[model samples]
Target: MSHARRLQRELQKMHQDVPVPGITMVNTENFTQWQMDIEVLDQNPIYHGKTFRLNFKFTENYPIEAPEVMFVRAIDREIPMHPHIYSNGVICLDLLSSGNGWSPVQSVESVCMSIQSMLTGNTKNERPRGDEQFVLGAGRSPRHIRFVYDDPTV
Candidate 1:
């Protein structure tokens, strides 16, 4: 199936089941790009009362490929401090990497939940090392970066 059709199907399912409470679809007008809101359920001091915006850009090869997922800074939302997340909104997760572990079975809901869980499990209140320099200088998309999966326990 085409990306549009698959997205429509996913959107339909999202509306029907609403599996992930922390994730809410913001826009689905464009299948290639989507917006969502994510919240950390656990009262992690780092993410308390914060709602983060996630931008998901899907390629034509989606499902077979992973979407470009990143946090967006807005009036009500700020990026949470995590070792795997850059200050500029780039996230370093094995599941979202195009180089590995991306499977056709993965959906936006699943990814969002994984991220929520990741944040919930984290105890460190620090951004990835060199986040300032990376955000100011890094101009490429998050998927292009060869981020070293330093910790699987996170």
Candidate 2:
């Protein structure tokens, strides 16, 4: 199916199903770009009372290729602090990497839950090493950057 059709089906399912706790679909008007707000459901002190915004940009190649996903800072929203999350909102999760861990079966909701789990399990209250340099030199899309997912334990 075309990417647009697939997205439409996903959107319909999202509206029909009981919403996942701590995960809200903020914007889905555009199939090319969507936004979601995710909160760590657990009592992770570092992320308590915080909601992070995620921006997903889907390409025509969509499920065949992973959509570009990243944290976005907006009014009243700040990026969550995690060792794998950069200061600029670029994430270093293997699941977001097309070559490393992405699969055709993954959907927007699944990605949000995975990210929520990532934040919930994280105890470190800091950005990845060299965050400044990486953010300063990073390109507009996370797909262009080569992130080394060396540490499995966040």
Best by TM-score: 2
Q: Which ten residues in a row have the lowest lDDT in candidate 2?
A: 144-153
For model 1, the local distance difference test gives: 0.87
Candidate 1 clashes between residue pairs 3 or more apart in a chain or in different chains: none
- Give stretches of model 2 more than 4 Å off: none
Q: Tell me the tens digit of each residue's lDDT in model 2 across 1-154.
A: 4999999999999999999999999999987999999998888899999999999999999988999999999997998899999988999988889795899899999999999999999899998999999989987679877888788677
- Compared to the true structure, candidate 1 yields what TM-score? 0.94
Query: Model 1: per-residue lDDT, tens digit, 25-123?
Result: 887789888988999987889898889999999999888889999998887989888998998889988899887668889998898988889899999
Lowest summed lDDT across 10 adjacent residues in model 1 is found at 18-27
Per-candidate Cα lDDT values, in order, are 0.87, 0.91
lDDT measured at residue 124 in model 1 versus the true structure, 0 to 100: 95
